[model samples]
Target: METVNVAELVERLGSDEDAVRKMAVFKLQGNIGDPSFADIFIAEGGLVRLRYLTLHASGNTLAYSLTSFSRLLDVDKGWECVDQELVERIVELIVTHPLVNILRGAMSILVSIVSHPYTGNRTSQINNFGFRALKPAIAIYPQFLEMLVSRLSSADHALCANALQLINSLMRDSITHDPEAEWPKFIQKLQDLGVIRAVYVLMQDSALQDLAHPLLEFQSLTKVLLRKWRDIPVNQEKPEHRRALKGIYLASNPEKNPDEATENGDDTRRSRRHHPEKWRRLGFETESPAGEFYEVGFLGMMDLADYVRSHGDEFQNMLLEHSTKPSRQRCPIARASLAVTSILYEHFEVEKSDMDDTKTYLISESRAGFDKLFQPLLLHWTRLHVAGLQAFFRLWKATAAEEEDLDKLIELVRILIESVVGGAARIKDVQDVEEELADFEYHRLRGLQMELLELTYEDAWGQHLRQVREELHHEALQFVKEQRIRSLLQGSWFALDSHSRSEPGPVQKSTATYQYAQLSHNRRYLHFGQFDLMGDRPPELDTLPEKISNVSVNPDHSSTATLKTAPRQPTTKITIHGYAPSTATGHGKGHSHARSGSRTTQKEVVLLTLRPSSHSIASEWLDGLLMLLNQQPITAETSKLIDLVSNYGLKIRLLNVRFDDATFAGEAPQVPARDGLDEDYYYDVFGGA
Candidate 1:
């Protein structure tokens, strides 16, 4: 208990008698919780003794030693005392130790260590701390993953939570840090090891109702993986790529390859340009390729509907179960279940038979499941509310051909519109309603209503729905305008200032500085100024364009632009050629002060160029500027820009593109792959060679 006795207690750790050694470890575990005691113990070489005990001790002694280390790791700079050798010993115990307490203790220590704040690449950090021990441990020792998966079923809530957290943390750190190199291997390993299945099974455990955060996190991370994995390219030699190539070859040489053509004659053929339309009809985005579809499979199957069907009862119960009071814990599981159900209903081949018996059954079950959440979601909006609405729309669309289901679908649509509009009206703040309308959920809701109007144009309910749709559409446009203004007003941009006289010189020949550029609150004047340590100075160039001509993105011309920083990303340049009033010349950090009574005006072209840190940021700026200009009649170029912005926004939101500044220092930005068939696979998929 005393600081003076800490040394004596640590010295007993090496006693010849097992009882004395165990007693010393037990005492150290209790005392190590105190920072001063931990400092004293480390000063007494207590960590070396603890490390030795972890490797050689057994039963309660090993558990006590791990507990002591866990306590020590809790203190400031305690992780600094841990070395790779000690981490290996702890990992060894994790894989081989039979005692539950020892395993729990070791897991806790590793979690504390891995989660310690660090700079630089996460992979480098893991390697430095010997956290890579688990990688090989799982690779060589088959039972390690199984052991972790088994613990997910443990009745001990802490153990269950820790096991889930440990696995999630490892996968996230490794895959996110080096997604291209690590993602496929790590995800495949998790799938092969049944880790994914274990998480699903854990969700079914009614006893561990309190483990919601970890459960929700694991499910969300899995969703991200599924989305990201679709973008990653598989080997060009894979059967999917080979088959696509052979089809193209046969289509081109139908006379010479008559046998091959006849073998595939039943297939409906389309040109490469028409592939996008075909995929869209199959319920895929135009951006997604047929090969990419084949790349996304769970548990080695292309379709997850079968798995959902197998777990149909459990999922139904998860969604349908309700508590008298709203349960925060229930919301996540319910949302996760809804997300899984959506996977089945959201995307399906339109040409396929309308509703097979299997689909009919799942729809019936999922509809009942959704019924329980509709009222609760309306009362209190959780993410489940969004998923519920989206899933219900997909369900409504699925039954489009069934005359018997038409009335029921219309009734549900009316109820949904009443609930949403009623909820919007309750929030008296006009801005709050606009904010709600801006969200993806409201967007989906509005879209569904519009679709319903098309299906029931002559129906009496159609008139009310059309009015609601128009109101929502108006609110959404207002929200977009507001967002553009807010974004323009809030942030300072890094603009490229080239000294070269030529137009848009290489970025290397230019310098970048923080520039305060924004449109006036009244939207009358465009303001520009330089930012200094103190704050923004007066405008250097304040001019509203007489004829705003062009806003576009061009590739960076800097030779030093590497994949780590730029990666073929473009920069946004706004070429505003217009006249300016004499007032545009003002006293500022970078411009001369105007003389009193100087009212001269001149016609001049002002070019503003922005070097965004990433493609998403560039797209954001371009979108804002284009919306601000609102050029007359919306040129074709401007329409294309709008479409580009929409696609980029969806991908950015899906990837949740928030990265630490340090993460971009020397690594490729781990974003989803670019749209279309991968350029790398061009030859393999369609080349004449």
Candidate 2:
């Protein structure tokens, strides 16, 4: 433990045998801050010994060795201590050495020491040391890059675990300004070395937790990927001849980014229209007259593109001459490949070229070929299958609490329904909700809902679950990403097609209008939506032009086009006016369906059917109805009504809540109807003069 003993240990290098020399050298691995120790290691190649094992230790010995080096990393100078320059130089040697095991160990130590969240005080010396070290480690030896690409492909849990941690540390400090300086360079190195493809392939595995933080968990890298892919490249000055230069740089690094938005990066966000030819889809098909090409089997299809890169043109001629693309749509191979390529391009800007020796490829051809190839591949594995189902269950279990089951379960059914709707090959187990829907999708949908309810019945939050019975009354008003748009098919949502090779209308699934919405509406909401239902009527009600309205060409068109059939009046607020005994609701983090806090109306509604003698009593109330329908915002009257509802609808004076433009907050009268109440009571409850 003493410096003299450590020095003695250090001095034993260059011995007759490799084993003792290795031992004596590693004993002082982290401990040897002595300039003389560096001298000894340098002569016998300390790095080579450090490679296999830091010491003959796993926990304490390893910890002490790493800690010793960490101790040196902070020193200002001299033979006995570590300083910034020395730390940087030492790290450079350890990680860049041929034996990757050494780099992994030293980095494990370095990252642990710097990122100890428990450290009470911020250490500038440590920060400087880290900055100095990380930038060069990335530059001098991106061999870890190859290791990353290799380990990610391996099924071993240990490899996956260590790889995730190592890659995660590389980008943690990208958020702040100071770290940004060195961070970008390291990112570029990763990008240049094709690190992104490896990470993306790992993400598709899904066995790993989705919630892992970027600094500590690789999932955090998703934000960076998404961010990079979502925007147009800033570089326009480059020549088209340099199309092969279609690459990404660290305009920003992942470390300084705190939000982790940059982690799950989008390819469109970072890609430049570089490599016009490279960007193109498969321009020409390989000889239509050729023989059957190589056929790969199902399950565990190694990423051919990645494999090809590591192995070279080996997979390029991986042909399918006599073979035909699988007729089946749900192949996982296609899908996983799609996921793999998208991630590669977005995260690493890694080009996956098809060297079929066929013909020239434009950006469009390259894109189309890739998409067609990837789709069937996606369905190759039943990723959304039963074990996948278990993974999903775990995800929900981790994210939602016992009481949050209602929402979590609902979301699960929704995703499953999507797989079926997308034609995913779901096994026809007795649990399937669609089996009962053979007669009609709507009834089948109800069956689906019932199944979801049954599954969650034992959940603690089960009692609170309410079937979301009513579908949206309006169809065309679907919200995607908070912007309203004309939805495509009923119940089908939209996402920007990262695969769309088009230029101006580059957005996928957009159909001229998709990004507008991210609503809570059920998929079926669009079927009977206002856009489809309103044949014709008042031009004022017509969101579309008159020319389009005339296209219906029916005899009743004139009458329907008249004002009588104006679109349903937009009601700004719904104030269910009723009296009730008191009720209570649990406190929540503002969840939409959280229980109310008071005892009052369990079920409440204002009856429009029966007439009140209101017309004869007061003319002023008519103005209030108009106000309610129009939904003017923040009117004193509306605020008062909101306050009353906020307090269990106790203090409201009017049965009406004026509209403040539809969808405004505090619109719904939050009161509930009390059970066991009288029907006739509605008449007398508010009949007092």
Candidate 3:
């Protein structure tokens, strides 16, 4: 590559000849990736010239200028040169651009600027700048989001992908940087802009099937954003109000001891510390440890649930049409559509006493519309299958008042449980247990089983369906036990049967124990001993603290001396770090408790390492241990359900997929042929240089 002079390119960018200016901008675009070139270009005023062209130039010159800015924004401090005025200009260009190439270039610049890794104090400030700049365009242009949604159906694949990516980036940046205040407003804006309706139409368009991956991401992120918005503090009160309440309570109750009040306050603070983690496990985002938020409430009547209900006929028809199609097993758009619909229905709630007859009729009509979907949803082996089952239970709980309705719902539940049980039995017989444990369908069946068990345990359902509930519970437990045995035989981690024991006991036989390490049934202790082939002696067990700090997997084993002589299998070294009760007595040296006349138990940080047979088994053990540490439910069925929902329902799988370079790179601008045209024709067709 020839070393081009940055000063010359900057001069040519302001040339009177249109072709000369266009070639210079294209050359600048190709070279902006170089740090040296970028620094020199900025110093030589090349960036200022490019920004000027974006406003003054048109067609190929304008598109290439934006593309160059997109690349330059990746360099250090490149965003600083683009001020609020320039950002507003870019947003304006995006709204008014006629050609697909121009739109692609403008959107790519926005994505680069929004998704840049701004660190330290500048992160929020820069994010706020970008959002503030777009506010005017979004406010003035009512069709901004709809215009982007329309691009989802464009023939240009690159343009379609870039449009979806830009939307995803914008939403992600809003929630991630400022979830509490700005995200809720952003979501409301998107709703008001009719983006949700546009999404519904795009999802139904069969011509856009190739854009399924990004579509799923957009759908899933929308659902997540709504849930996050709901999780925000509804009561936006100041901290002073809480302090005032505390003072009032203390002043009213003079008999209350100050020490007792302090202790109670401490307990409340401790519980608040764990509140965020608990809600996060249930798929809700939490901003602070205080976790002040309401449950998913009615976000007025225009929420997603209301939208689906209002369009019940069309929504049901879409479901029926997709479910009947004979296509590939994996339908990203269809699966995502059902998942979103399921979430909407699940979040649907109404106050019966406050509801008028119109509201009641709408609810009943929506329920009936969903009732038709249960047959096809149950037949499919997708993640939506479990979601559909859960939606059915929730809807039934909300509206099923008559005994005939209850009877029909109970029979449907019975059939679903039977189907899940039969599926599990066949899987156990035909498939490898290890593979089945990792399969999504296997987890889906497990989620169905758990949902059925939960239904059986409900007080209202238990009273009406006593005999059937009993049978379902018994079958579910039997299936669980069989799975536990199979998982152990395959050398994978299996949750111990807690019903067999009242308290912590010896390690369960169903748990796979390596030669020198074992985890107790209650998962409260880890036992380690010398390697022994015979059942001769017991291993020394140490109590694990309630909170485990960390669990890590290390693949390198050559550093350990014990494994030096052992044959190297596909091994993985697992390390755990946490606090454990110290074994030292009060009489021992360095015992501060002895001097203080109090024999308080001291805790010490301990590290434990174990070598598992294979990487997959190590990962299974790691997941189980992390779950135990996080205080999440550890039953086999619950684990499977959490995995299924996190992966498919929440579309967490999108975290791994990203837009590559090709998605952002715009097609080269086409130049007109100059066979018989005069030089004036060039200046007339294109804008003046």
Candidate 4:
């Protein structure tokens, strides 16, 4: 390789020939990282020359000059070579540059300077050069924010993307490094500048999707701005916004006039400029990098779960309308939006007025919004995109928080169950999907897999996802059991007779309504209709079983209160109370009807007067209730027997019906041999015993 002369390149950077200037700038760009080169560049007036070319040169020379300056400022000692004058010059060139490459070059330098660390090197440590340059550079934050926002409307996509990234870097620095007192005011100023609205507009640009860096940065910045201002009331007084380009001339050009002093007009201004050390104290160095960046658009309108929580119907309509575009549906943006939307809908709170009809909420507007939100998620299950699947699990987490009401929760759980089942089965089908994908698309999917693997099953979130699924399955099983119990208890029955110690009251000739009956099967619980019973609506009933004691039936017969004993007919007078000792009604060895063994005694009071039907029907119900209490099977025969017993004036006492399967067991009886068969009838023929 030929020997290169730093002196010659420095001189050539000022050449009348464009080729010489371009060559010099490019060679200088290669040497900004070398401490020796940075030293010589600073000593040989390289910063002054580069600023000259950036502001005065044109075409390739200007682009090359800006690139050289950006590279120089990107290093530790190199930051010292430039100052506020050069920073203002670079901003000026970016704002005024006609060529796209020149604009990109200048904006890159600004971003490099803005995101430059306070602790990246020793020189920055010694003289605080990074802050010296940054103090004034940051003053341009408001200006650059507006510049990028306006450029977002540019017809040239590459320029718009570059502008967006520079804007993001600038805003990130301000929030992360600026005075804590200044944060709210800065954020409010940004909001007033329409930063949020501009990002949304840029997101809609079809041309920018392929530009991953700027597109992603725009999303990240939007999220930060949102979370910062999320709690700030919109109607509050606006912060006293600093003017755009407010501090462009805070420090005079050291290159143009090395003796120029910083202005000190007001006492406050003197205190601020005299204390550049105070600027360094602003904790910019400690800002940790923002958390893992999700590629899927979680910052979009679709990502705002708060919006959906407060304004669901309107947002649902917007999402549906947005999804109809073929371009939007095919892009990665739409997939992210849909994934998040589905999750938000799962845990969506029904309004207080709407809670009475939760099922209707799930099936609203002919089910169009529900289908739109979830159909794509189910369809794409085979793809195994981690973000989408994580969103699915997140939805489960939110739903489980309020899954206590078995009936209400099951409605949503069934949808999730179907999705999980279908997704588990869909893995085999994904192999047929073409393995080939475009570079951007492939990187997107790979990013998703990395994020998912980071939350391997042993981690809290992974364990939580598994927990939610298990919980849903458990709830579903309980729901099914309750339904079965409900189906058994709901039916018509005849009450033939009722006897009480007290005189019977007049009975109304109406059918009995037995919608709920508490039972003590395994553990105790009150049973109500799981599904609607025989009415326009299911009756609401308490789910905890209640006990009653000393219950006696009082029945009124229109024709006769008691029958004549002449024909061996029994009298209708019956006394059901005190038939069994109090201890016998408690948790005895054979008392299967009792609940809560802790209770010393639980006398179940069967209120027979609630039955308006005949005595035969009333007794059938009593048999049913007893069967439920003892956890015994009550079939059609049991009902018939109870009815027949009631007609004969003999009530079947379920308390005495104890199951003793051991006593019922017996060996088969020995068979007696037939006389002719045991005889020698075959012995004479075959001699075969």
Candidate with best lDDT: 1
lDDT of 4 by residue, 546-614 (tens): 222212222222223331122223332222121122453542112223333443454433222222243
| Segments in model 3 whose C-alpha atoms lie over 4 Å from true places | 116-128, 140-142, 177-182, 192-194, 197-220, 229-689
TM-score of 4: 0.35
C-alpha local distance difference test of each model:
0.49, 0.33, 0.48, 0.44
Segments in model 4 whose C-alpha atoms lie over 4 Å from true places: 1-3, 16-19, 30-45, 55-59, 122-144, 153-158, 201-210, 221-689
RMSD of 4: 28.6
Sequence-dependent TM-score of model 3: 0.39
- The alpha-carbon lDDT assigned to residue 330 of candidate 1 equals 26
Clashes of each: 0, 114, 0, 13
Candidate 4 residue 355 C-alpha distance from true site, Å: 39
lDDT of 4: 0.44
lDDT (tens digit, per residue) of candidate 1 on 506-531: 11222334444665565544455434
Question: TM-score rank, highest first?
Answer: 1, 3, 4, 2
Quote each prediction's TM-score: 0.41, 0.30, 0.39, 0.35
Cand. 3 Cα-lDDT:
0.48
